[model samples]
Target: MYSKTILAAAAIAGVQAQSSINSTSGYLNYTTVTGYFLQDLASTNVSTFDYTATNFGLINRTYPATAGLKANLTQWQQFEAQVNALNADAPLNTAYKVLFLGRHGEGYHNAAQTFYGTPDWNCYTSLLNGNATASWFDADLTPNGIEQALIAHDFWAHEIATQKIPYPQSYYTSPLTRCLKTANLTFSGLDLPQYYPFVPSVRELLREGISLHTCDHRRSRTYIHDLFPTWNIESSLTENDELWNGVTAETSDAQDARSKIVLDSIFSEDDHTWISITSHSGEIASILRVLGHQSFSLSTGAVIPVLVKVTFLPSGPPPSNPPYTTSTHCAAPPVTSIASLAQGCVCSGTAVGGITTPIFNISSDYPTSAGYQATDLGPVVTSAPAISSYSY
Candidate 1:
């Protein structure tokens, strides 16, 4: 995360939730789900303005300027406005598009774990191990994950209704079931027919940060298509998870290279200027970098809207459509494995620390950049050593 604060334009509309300022954090964190999204969320609340039909504006959120992302977005918005001023007959107008990027809701792996108050050397391997007591390979969203999607869906629906946001003419998702499910859940009930198309296709290039993590391992294409019949899978994608091996994974540079190819295609094709991308938090960071911005962190199920502008010279070959390819390169460090410790807990994660009670911190014996939230995560591990009483 960067130090620059961004303009927050998307406030919760018709909210009846209660919020209190944390004397320590110095930000208003709303903890209720009374807002129409039908899920709990924490945001920096600025006002209590009630927007009615007369005073209309529904805001989901505005992206923070983390890691130069907001700066890139700002440049794109300016470029787009300039393009609109150019004559439609001019050749440059067709070369650019704006895409909205987002992450999936909580997956089973995201749910805290069940060490069950005692460590099992066989069952609980390294923090990066996916062979947990309760694991979901290439997982689907948990119930709480579904709710998070609904909240995003509600936000998009409201924004579309008020014309605060544009409708997506093209939609793409990672082949992973979790991402596919999240894309569907988020746009299922849009007021516009085209908002949620009959089929949202998967793009192999959109897969999560490839690594040794089992959760990153994808099932065969036939298996995924069998589960989601209405959706379309890329014919070029290999039948099996050829891109990922539990042994060797795609590095950040490789993923960034892939992000570039996919993004160029998305921007160059004359199909649609407004697009949506559903992918993982790790990979999204790479995508942001390929677009000429520094990467920022995203929690599970969080979204950041971006207005992308592709610059085309007076003469050049158009970008290739689909069948995009990227070279592999950078090894991502191991991410910690999270546990569900208790049943009925929501599954979510964030690399950034926040107002929520701290679970795993830098002080831990195995301090990790990774963190989990949703109903007690670490009391089981607290007594292991000089651990502090965990709260989040």
Candidate 2:
């Protein structure tokens, strides 16, 4: 099934070599895998939900204004630097995949009449509503929510078994029950065994509407540390300490820093690895934007398994007289087909006898002029070609 054919009666081709070019030490590579959004499945206009005002608190005039504040420039720079470093260290064929940003399916907030009944109220009213009675970080997944996690698990498991795509080597999660539950469900199906860490800096932001008690924070830390001893909890959540009362530290800045550290540690050149992260929609979207993808949405059951490939070229002189630069490409596996052959199929047109052949067949036997029968003969069968075109 594999052969190289060249039909060149007359053809012209051009190749160029540039002697001077700046050789960058590294490049940036990333991909965003969007999870299933509940709003999308409901067929409701997400624009109406006002993510800026409701989920993100960006549009709120009360305390946290949305657009005026500049992103922490220093942290942003470090984040970018880490990405570039990873690109440099990654193998020529390395690809990065980011996944699991979505809402918890059908929660108590959605079931409560007082919460969902009010329009212009936050979609995440369970956290907001200023109700101390509500659980802050450890909200149990509703029955439907568990089903959503299962759906994501099924999708990921299928990808691993059929496509030979590696399961993530490391795991990360927000300190929220729903997020942790989602991670558990996904890891349950995969064969890989690895530890995961929970970053409270990222998780605290998701708990914006909920009042965080010291006890809650302590419990959350212990839960994650038990699973991942190497977790950087002290660095991640130290800002909550009374010692740093005067210093101004934004959650966004902390998140940016944490992402840099985590990404750098997880991605390596030795072996093919996958990393899974379960986090809230807001934090996931923010991380995606930081990674150079401006448009990404997370749904309840949505699972985005990003495929990131990294490559490095030889380092050369400065911009004045540059050296050869390496290139990298990032792509998500298609949602429709996970099989290895189908995954690699790309169409190129080269007519054998001024006729193009179908890339895929629905059935082995195509109806011929003589009769309907299965035949392994060439395209021309029973004195005539049985088919003209096919689509998958």
Candidate 3:
């Protein structure tokens, strides 16, 4: 992926030599081309905004590029035509693409987070594979999650039938189960163009932000292939997850750097202007930041479309991406949680031995183990005068 953005340099004395490229040789610049989507409008309150009601945030207006077209064309049709025009007239090293970013529906992890509350979820529950009730390691979508995806399916059908919205020319999804399931449900039966099929390429980089949470970990590539055999997996992907260390979480800056690299890979390799990416909240947020879009958080099952303008730069210094930082966790379920503090889980009892990562025993329901032995879950201490925080 770095091939597109960074120029290769010679290795000096068995160590990689850094290229001394000036302003003429490295990197790409991404700018969000506003005015095409209502999400970019200053007055559109994201919290109260519903895309299903507002025609996917498309501004129902004319475009000068499609001025000579038929007057009866729908807003979507006009928008598509204008996008085509923009691409057709684009100069060297410049291109426009519309990215449909869809977040995976409610996963068991999300429900667990809600059930346990954020503080406990962040501190204790997230570290374990599951409680007595539900499992969240590489969590699957809940029942409502399926319904949410179906709603997206129905909306897309409506848009295709009435609005003639441009269907995605290419499809991509995160390797995680929830995202894979969401992408499948949302696009499988759509009345799509002959050239554009529902076959999405599973990208390793598209998964949720790297973290110690078991849900953030992904199953093996073989397991993913067994489930979605028809979908193409990026050849570079390893069979097992090699990135997750179960000790640290990616900083926001680190996530943004990853997001930039992935976007760079897509833009350099793919020619499609309309692309669909089914991923997680954190990843989409990072991508939006890289694209220079405003911070508009998406609810699960919601989608955002952004018009992006990419410029290939000749040369620039590479960015310094910070390393992942260790996350604080509780050895046992905290007696009480503090929402205001980072070390919020107030644990009196010491966690003896907590399972850091999932046990890789294959099952139909879980690609990994059904649940791991959380030795850390000792008898809950009722009260404590002093508490100590632990890092997983």
Best candidate (score: lDDT): 3
Question: TM-score for every candidate vs. truth?
Answer: 0.56, 0.42, 0.83
Candidate 1 lDDT score at position 358: 25
**Judged by lDDT relative to the true structure, which candidate is superior, 2 or 3?**
3
What lDDT is reached at residue 353 by model 2? 13
| Runs in model 3 lying further than 4 Å from the true structure | 1-25, 335-345, 349-392
Ranking of all predicted structures according to TM-score, beginning with the best and ending with the worst: 3, 1, 2
In model 3, the worst 10-residue window by lDDT is 383-392
Cα lDDT tens digits, model 1, 1-392, are: 11113211111111111111111111111111122111111342213322222111223333232233434333223333332332132232223334467789888766633232112211222123344355455766889889888877887776656443445667888988789889989987677564446367688778887653446667676766777877777776666655543333455665665676665444433245556889998888887776654345666777764434344333343332222122111122212222432111222243421112222221321122121111233342211110011111
lDDT of each: 0.48, 0.35, 0.75
| lDDT tens readout by residue for model 3, 58-142 | 9888898678776788998888777766665665556677899999999999999999888678778887788888889899999
Worst 10 residues of 2 by lDDT: 383-392
Candidate 1 stretches greater than 4 Å from native: 1-94, 112-133, 194-198, 313-392
Q: Cα lDDT of model 2 overall?
A: 0.35
Alpha carbon RMSD to native, model 2: 28.2
Q: CA shift at 7, candidate 1, in angstroms? A: 39
Q: Going through the candidates in order, what is the number of backbone clashes in each?
A: 8, 15, 6
Clashing residue pairs for model 3? 24-314, 24-315, 25-314, 25-315, 26-314, 26-315
Per-residue alpha-carbon lDDT of model 2 for 175-248, expressed as tens digits? Answer: 55566566666556455434422222223333211111111121344454554455444334322222111111
Best by TM-score: 3
